[model samples]
Target: MTLPTPPRLTLTPEELRALTTLYTTDGAWTVEEGRRHCDRLDVLLAAGVLMPVQTLLGMMYQLSPQGRLQVFGTKDLAHSLRRQQDRAYLRLCLQHYGWTRTTPHTTRHLTNYLGGRQLIEVMTDGGPALVGGQMTSGGYRGLAIKEIGERLRSPALHDRFQVILFTPRPSMGQTAAAPFANFLTLIPLVPAGEPDIHYGVPTRAQYVPPPPPWDTDFEWDTPHITASMAVRLRRDDSPLPRSSVAILCEPRSARIARFKADLTMDLAIADTQLRRHYGLSAEDIEGVPFVDAVLRPMHANTSLEVQTAVYLRSATLAYRNDAALMHLVGVGEMRRHLNVVYPSQWTVSTAGRHRIEEPDALWHRGAFDVAVEYDTGEYKLHHVLRKLDGFASRGLRGPVWGVPSARRAAFLQGEVGSRLMEPPLVTQWWLPETPFMV
Candidate 1:
């Protein structure tokens, strides 16, 4: 009952031009470009090569995965496609925590004392602020309370701006917390969410403390405190079950944007580390994108990377335990490896056309690797069986799944493997401890 998919042909110059126009313009084909390349664009649309995404700027055209692969060639396309996905993922996560980016990221030059370097500035629902610089080899040094106080004392500006920090430790520890509790807020970007697997080890569960009592009489001076007050007063008292650490963190608008940026960097570094650990050199990883190449099957079919990026935060929190040696391999890498070794069976037509055959993720731990397919309540038993069957044919063992609940975990093990361990939930690292805001 299956029809053979047509051979994916190389992109002609005209086709490549169309894809480039969309790609370079950040997936937005201005009306002028559209008119000039209308014929080619039309062809692409008919062939399901371009996906139209509507934005405030007007209509934008994004290359479908097939379009990217065919036009840019997988090598070059991987970087562009993964970056596109990363930005989209960051924006969505920011929105989830109530931040609507008010302005496009802008760069401002600071004085020589700060090295005259360009700093990235972002405006959100909270306020206009300067984003922290990218993490360096020394790791992220959080924005200090004294630094904010100094900026407040700056003669050029008065006390008008807020300093948002993107550090793993979102809270100013007890020593600093009490003093600057009203001055600044710490929002943890724990990627814990309802669908995350945070229960692998009992100790891995980030303790969720009882909600802080809303104080009507308390003075709310800083934006952070004010925002926390609003959220606490607005929500119901009933506690929700713990999952991703993000659940415990306050969802301030600024926190959301900062979290988005911070986690994006963390995931990027994790991919590089995994690749190098697995013996992949920089030359070997040239065109392979981070999420697509390393975080592959997880980010391929669904928005799992964007949704559970905080999972890395949880994984890091548990690194002292079993997750220390864990690494996530992308499905593209697996496919490429399979094709290079057995091109007759794993060519583009056969491997690229089918998602069922593609494992959601390749979980590598020492010598025992498992092909993973996440069960987010979207697949039936037959669907899962087929994925397992496909992996088996490739001399692979499982699409070792990470289910959402204990009940589902039990069912899967009964049907899959008895030794399978439950994936950990995405719990916050600073659980049971109140952040600056709440």
Candidate 2:
């Protein structure tokens, strides 16, 4: 009978690290030279992956030919050294850039020895780089580190850059506004006086981005897991983490939905957002329990969070179009930032039987309290009329319907204008002209 092909063996991270350190020596390394070497060298030595030689200069360790064969499956130390060196250089490159591409020159070198795993590409300011060659597992697995496709709310899950790398140890300088940072922006890395000295990354970055939002991780949907993997995610058959209902029900996500100029809040990260971040298969955007619960809440209070999300999403669209708030004020960069008071902050109704109507939001535009409604276009005609009638009772001005687009705005205008004699004070998709302009 023919023997099955022997499973190709590969080096563990520790072993690989030790071998790379040893490979740097011209012959043998004195113990003194091994001071900053990997601590796993002893493990490698015990395994006969390296042997000590008694030389005129005292004792030194050298990788034995037998050790080379055992460790690398090849006796050619030079060849294996080159591979390790390439892996290190490439890994360091990926670390520094967060994402980078190989040039045609480097690609020519890597293409010949190429082997691969799940293909990943890095997009830099330079361009997308297809890192060709043996992409070993461990430090480089899962998603390719890049900043795009990331959700940027407060309690951010990713910084501007995502890199699979060893934590860089760099000395920090004084935390003050330094005018020198302008010149630093043109320079990318450091020159530590080594191989790529002026080429490789420095101990400190010349240009540092502003501090990112607070970082956070997700509570994945791994349910019914045994003690084995349950502990892996800090769970013991607990129902809360995977329960989208529980997640969306929390106040944090809703609070985040209502935002300002540089909107910062946390995530009740939707299923689609999470999947897109990891490059998982595209699925429905309205995540389970999240959308259903948001759309079909048991009560008004239950739907508050969903409304808050819509409120923000619509606000963002308006902000982009420079939307007018109740035709009183504009919302965008060149214009003034809106100081919004959300529904939860509404004062209780004092009039007998006056069902305390709360519009989606009220934009305090210095001289005006412009009432705003974030319409999802799902409201029934009666529901829409009821909401409008409630706003009409407020008696200061007509309400602003923050619809999805100009088409929706026009449609809403036609619907409401035909019924109400006053019509909407302004039916506009773009930001409002100040009430003074009105």
Candidate 3:
């Protein structure tokens, strides 16, 4: 939100203080005394008999704190006496008409004796003449007389009086000023008993706005992390296992060595038995097609390190999909750095087909292709078996073997990992150096 610029003022704090003191102290002088003081100061020097100083003093008294005149020095006595006389005249008129004057001024005693019984008749009968003649061309005093007439005539008003007085009007001038009757006669001089009128004026603060309510539940300091994170990280030690093994059964990293070794050992044993039975030398069977078939199992035990790297990259991508680091190193960059290598022999036969019996198990079978497809129909049964075993070792369930009923049932019900390395309808070849299994 934009803020307003602070206000600039020419007056210094000291000067403002002096001005305030002068206004408050000298402002309480009688109207005539205030006028004379203005005349001497060469201020408020208007041409009329009633000086503007009187107007200024009257306004200050009504508007300032406490709404009462302040005490000026001895030189201000004459002006004070003149103002007292005017107030006295008004009080005399009020008391003479049998209208209550709460505090009659000292100067009003003589007029009270003369006009005491005649004021009501004079005011009632001469309402129009008093209002129009006195109010139309008269100054501040004239307006006061007019207002008194209006209040007396108003049917809605109760506790009516002949006159009401306001020491200093709220605003000055013909248009802005409150009507004398309204300020002086209409508003009641409410007794001190009512809490609102202890000082004979409205109790509301003039210009201040009401303050905002307190916010008891507001917090200045909130916890940084969310509750879910707190719960997930609440362990006393390491949250994950010390070491993990991930397998990628692609052509580059397949466990072919162990399979080949096992197959070679089995083949050698079978060949020895066969040769012994048939009385044939090992060299005689060297170029047989069965020998090459036996060697196929060796490809099963490939490089575990390369496969682990690929799986680690895939896991990272899956886990840190929304991390800032992932964005910093773009997804394409990450894929290049950690490529997923699957066995070349394991082709996706039915790339987009859904299984009729196990439709809901598609994700578990690795059948749902996110970026690459994995299916059994287009791949050899032996290749699928190897891939399934590799995936199972790495905490994943492999795809279902889609073959004829008997063959598929045999494949599913067989020792899944062992059969993948078992020779088929051909004698297996051998490799000596590689381990039989990982």
Off by over 4 Å in 3: 1-204, 207-438
Report the Cα RMSD per candidate: 23.8, 27.2, 44.1
Query: Per-residue lDDT for 1-438 in model 3, tens only?
Result: 122422322333543443344344322333443443443322222211122211111211111111111122221212231233233333333333444422333222322322222121223221311111110001134344454445444431343323333222222233423444342332222111112221332221111122233532442233322344334433423121111011112121122222232223221222322221122223322232221000011122211001000011111121111111112112211111222222221222221122322211222115432211122123465755555555455443333322212343354446452533221111111111112111
lDDT of 1 by residue, 1-438 (tens): 223434564567876876776665433343344556656666666565665532212233556656666766552314333334323323333444565434434323222123332223446455655433211111122234345434533522543444443322333233443444443443433222121233321122232223335633442322333445345533643122211122224333333343333333232223332221121223322222221111222212332111111123333332221111112212222322222222222211111123666665454444655565545444577876787778777655444465434566556667655433333122112122223322
Candidate order by decreasing lDDT: 1, 2, 3
Q: After superposition, how far is residue 54 of candidate 2 from its true place, in Å?
A: 60
lDDT of 1: 0.37
lDDT of each: 0.37, 0.33, 0.25
lDDT of 3: 0.25
Task: Count backbone clashes in candidate 1.
Answer: 15
Q: Candidates 2 and 3: which is better by TM-score?
A: 2
- Could you arrange the candidates by TM-score from highest to lowest? 1, 2, 3
* TM-scores, all models, native as reference: 0.26, 0.21, 0.14
